[model samples]
Target chain A: MHGKKLALKITSYCFLCLFSLFFLFPFVVMFLRSFFTATESLAIGSGLIPKVFYPKSYLDALDPDFLKYTGNTVIVIIANVVGKPLTAAMAAYAFVKVRFKGRKLIFYTAMCTIMLPAILTMIPVYKIFVDLGWNNTLLPLTVPAFFGGGFLNIFLTMQFIRSLPKDMDEAAIIDGANILQLMFRITFPLIMPVIVLVAVQSFFGAWNDFMGPLTYITDERLLTIPVGIYNKFFTAVSPLEAQPNVQMATGVIIMIPPIIIFCLFQKQLVDGVTFTGLKA
Target chain B: MNKNTKYKDILKTGKTLAALKSNITGYLLILPLLIGLIIFTIYPLLLSLYNSFYLDYDGFNNYSEFEFGFGNYIKAFSGYESKLFFKSVGITFSYAVIMVPLGLVLSFAVALFLNQKIRGMVVFRLIYYIPCLIPSIVNAIVFGYIFNSEDYGLMNTFFASIGIPAREFFYSASSEAVVTFAVMSLFGVGGAMLIWLAGLKSIPQSYYEAATLEGSGYFTQLFKITVPLCTPYIFYQLITSVIGTIQICDQVYVLTSEGGRDYSLLFYGVYIYREFQRNNFGYSAALAYMLFIVIAILSAILFRFNKYVYYEGDN
Candidate 1:
């Protein structure tokens, strides 16, 4: 039995290591190739380290237009990271503590929209934005976040709120706390972890959102990081051969914020995923 | 008797007033969400359904010129558009069929290993998760560069180093495009792995002890104990991933620029996007409805056949 256990442990380690490398391969390649000279980036077996450590790619990637795009991305992320959680929590609080006639009906209706494939609504939403003249502006991306946030965020938060003891709410009510006051002061503080989860998720969602920005914002000046990077690296109009190193640099830069955020909230994120799975 | 009746009526009116006040407050608190749902989700859904009937695209932005009929839906069903639509739908289904199971098995295996009490397990888990943390667009770009069709591509380079011949990936032939994407799906398996790990952790250690005492080996325990217990998690992953993979647009769009050679990578989402970009609002809206129907039916079927999922208390 001891020998068999040893064998199993060894096999597990081996498999884990191999899969780790497999998962890490693209990031490794992205990191290394970003520093390579233009030709070396395209070359086969160009060694792990670049012949000349190139900072030119990094410099080129930080051009004024790219910086502006970064700003645009930050604005969108901030709008969502703040708006989504706040509104989602408010909405969640309503569902959990507040007594209303249509509360169940409204909550279930909102939850049902969770199954609605985003593609189903994209066209009409696009038309609505176009008709409103909100197209080509960040309003298309940001304004809706303030409304209800998203159903998923609200759902996640609602679960968290439901798990809280109801006495806290009852006590607050007895103390003459208004609904908003109870949410902002009592429930919000206790549910900060889930709120953080929603905020971080929102940050990543807005950050990685390619299609939304790609659709609404046509002006080059207003492009977010994803669309900006696309026009720079992957478009036929702009040849991929122009700057492989720069493309990788920009890609690496774009990946850093999420990685840092992930590391910071790693435990919560993992737990949150599990929580969502079980509850959902 | 009259005075008593008057007091009772006053009490009744007071109670009703309090209920009305509470209802108003509740509605006000949730007003943002209610308005958002109406304007964003409900309105768009209905308008999308409504727009599918109209067919008029002459490059002008005038909605007044649009003719009312089912021409857009009909166009999608009977012609080259029909061929493309069904083919794209078929390709998407195949992609889902290939990827969902692949992801489940691979992520489950990884999660099982990661769940073991071992040194450096956290590092191993984090390494696996880093791929998932990479933004999808960036992942697409990185994969695009790494899987570049030419000899200079990173994978091809690795093949050369290992004495294997270079193979064209995602570019050479339409046959390999979907497969290439299915293979690329491996990178994002960390998300599912996390859920699987949660499922594994929830399984009581006593079950394993009982199995061990019965002289059941590792494989037996895994198959009989761990696998059965994790079925609910598997069910959830299946439903979510099926919906997700069917809506695959960004990766194909970002990687190939236009759905690869022969439109082999043009999944339904990308097709909808392309039509939308081309200003075929009615056609794309119709296509969007079709996708909605497909998803709804699939989800309904999955939920209907969820008897295989084992909840602990069910027995």
Candidate 2:
């Protein structure tokens, strides 16, 4: 029995390690190739690692235009990461703590919109943005976040709020705190974990939102990093300069913030996802 | 008696006033969300439905001067566009059909492995999930590089090292584009794997203890207790992922040079996007409505199957 258990353990470990390589291999190659010189990267037999650590590829990838695009992306990220959580938590508080008529109906209506794909709203929303003269600007990408963010964020915040104790909020109300004060002062601080989770999730979502910027922002100057990269590298028949090493370097640069955020908030992110999945 | 009646009237009025106050406060608190829903969701939904029946829209400002009544819908069903539209629909269906189940099963297996009592399991889980942290566009680009058809590409290079021929992955003329996409999607299985891990953790260890005491094997406990209990999450993941896979456009758009060679990768969502790009507002709205209907029907069918899902603590 002992030998059998030992064999099973070994097999499981071997399987896990092999699978880890499968997940990690591309990232490893991405990092290595980014460090290779242009000629070395194109050469199949030049080995997996760079012959010499090349800094020129990074410099070449970080053109002025790319840097500008990064700045635009940052503006978008800040707007969303700040706006989504605050608005979503406020909405969640109304649903959870405030006594309201037709509340269930309204909440269900919001929740049901999750099934409706965003593509359905693309055309009319585009027209509305154009009519409002918000086209070719970052407003299209950022302004809606201030309204209520996505319905999913609101729903997730609501779920988190539901799990909190009701006594705290009742005490605040009894002490003559208005609904807004109860939400902003009492509840918001207590629900900081979920608020942080929503913010981080929003940060990632805004960072990766390519299609929104692609559709709304026609001006080259206003393009986000993802869209700029798509137009700069992928659209043409051949990639710009055909320098795979430079492209890899650009990829490395774009991937850094998300990786850093993941490292910093790994626990919160894991718990949040687990909470969303299990609770929902 | 008159004084008592007057006092009762005041108390009743006070109760009604409090209810009214709470009602207004609730609306006030959710005002931003309410306004957002109306403008972004409700207005657009109604407008899209209305636009689906009309044509000749110079812009949203004037649709009254244009021809109206099922013209766009008819064009979608019968013409040159019809064939392309149906092909795209077929591709979307097949991709979703293949991917949704494949993702669920594979992630479930990974979760089972990750859930095992062992050292470094958390580290393994984190490593597995790291791929999901990277943005999809970057992921598409990296995968495009790795799966490039040339001998210099990563996959081809590895294949050549082992004496296999280079495979055309998402190349312009590649017929294997959909399959290649499916393979690329496996890298992000970590998201679903995390969900499945949550589900697995929810299953009681006491159940396994009971099973072991009855001399049942590991596989037996897994199938009997674990799988049955996991059906609820499996159902949840199924509905969400099916909706997701069907609407796949960003990856296809980024990877292919205009919807792949021979339109092999022209998904329904991309087709809608193309129509909208051509200023075909009515046509695109019609297409979007069709997609909404398809998803609604699919969700309804899945929910119908919810009877088989086992919920904990339910009789």
Candidate 3:
């Protein structure tokens, strides 16, 4: 029995290690190739690591165009990251704490939007934006966040708030706090962890958003990073295409902020995601 | 006695007034979200439904008058352009049929393995989930390079090192494109795995202990206890993955040039996008409605299986 248990443990470890390596290999290759010289990048049978360390690829990738796109992306990201949580938290607070008729009906209606895929809304939303003269600007991409963000964020925030004690609300009410004060002063501070999770998730969503930016932003100068990268590689005949290292470097640059955020808030993110899946 | 009853009636009215006041405050609090929903979600949904039945435009640049009927839907079903729509539906169905189950099983297995007691398990979990942290566009681009149909591609290089022949993935025939898409979907299995892990964690240890006391082995316990209890999570995964896979666009767009050879990789989402680009707004709206219907039907079917899902604390 002891020998069998030992064998099982050994096998499990080996399996995990192998799978982990498979998961990490692409990232490893991408990171290493980002440092390769242009010639080395295209060379047949070149090793994973660069022959000579090259830092110029990063510089080459960050031209004025790329910087402009990065700036646009940062603006959208800030709007989304800050706006989404605030709106979601307020909506969630209403659902959880407020004594209202038809609250369940309203909350369910909001939750049902999760099932309504974004594809269904794409054309009409685009037309609306175009008609409003908001197309080619970041307004269409970021403004909706200030209203309600996504249904998932609001749902998650509501779940977190539901798990908190109701005594806090009673305490605040007894202390002569109004409904808005109860939400903003007491409940918001208590649910800060979920708010952080929402902010991080929203930041990533805005940063990596392709379809929204692709549809709304038509001008080159107004493009965000994802659309910019797509245009650079696929749409236009940019000089960077021949330099694979610089392309990889651009990818690495775009990838860094999200990775850093993930590293810093992995626990809250995992908890929030799992909370969403299991609880929902 | 009449005075006392009158005093009670006034107290009751005052209490009802306070309730009414709070209800209005509650509505005010959620008013912003409700307004957004109406404008962005509900109104657009209704408009799309209406547009699907009409021909509103001539081409990409022309804005013609609308003829309200089922003309666009008829065009999508039996007209000359119907062939592409049907083909996209078929492709999307097959992709979802393969991708959803494969992702579920693989992610479940990973979660099970990772749940084992081991040192540095948290670190390992994070490492595994790192791929999901990479933005979708970047993930697609990196995978495109890795699976590029060249001798220098990462996949081809690895196969060659293992004495296997190189296989064209994204640039291959239709069947191989399906395989490539499935492989690409696997990269984000970490997200599903995390959910599965949470499901596993939520299962009480007492149940497993009880199973062990009854002389059940690991496999038996897994099949009988773990799988049954985790069915809720699995069902959630199933519904969402089906919806997600059917609407897959970003990766396909990034990987394929001009919709791949012979439109083999033209997914439902991409087809809708193309129709929009051609200014076939009504036609695209029809396609979108069709997608919505399919997802609703699939979800309805899955919900029927809730009978088999074991929920604790429910009699």
Best by DockQ: 1
- lDDT, candidate 2, B1-315, per-residue tens: 999999999999998898899899889878888888899899999989888888645345478777889888888889898888888988898888888898888988888888989899878987898888877778866887788877678888889988998888887454588888888889889999988888888888999999999999989988999999988888889898999888888778888635777788888888888788888888889889989998999999998878888877777
For model 3, residues A1-280, the per-residue Cα lDDT tens digits are 8999889989999989999898988788788998999887766678687899998989998999899999999999999999899888888888877789989988888878877768888889888898888996889888988887778888888889988988988988899988878878888899999999999999989888888888888788999998888887666453345477877888888878987898899889877865683543
What order do candidates take by DockQ, descending?
1, 2, 3
Candidate 1 vs candidate 2: the TM-score winner is 2
Candidate DockQ values, in order, are 0.68, 0.65, 0.64
- Order of candidates by lDDT, top first? 2, 1, 3
lDDT score for residue A85 of model 2: 92
What TM-score would you report for chain A in candidate 1? 0.92
Residue B198, candidate 1: how far off, in angstroms? Answer: 1.7
**What pairs collide in candidate 2?**
none
- What ranking of all candidate models by TM-score puts the best one first? 2, 1, 3
Error of 3 at A33 (Å): 1.6
Candidate 1 residues lying further than 4 Å off, grouped into runs, are A44-48, A236-241, B1-7, B56-64, B159-166, B312-315
| DockQ-better candidate, 1 vs 2 | 1
TM for candidate 1 is 0.94
Over B78-105, each residue of candidate 1 has an lDDT whose tens digit, in order, gives 9788888887888998878877898899
How many clashing pairs does model 1 include? 0
Top of the candidates by TM-score = 2
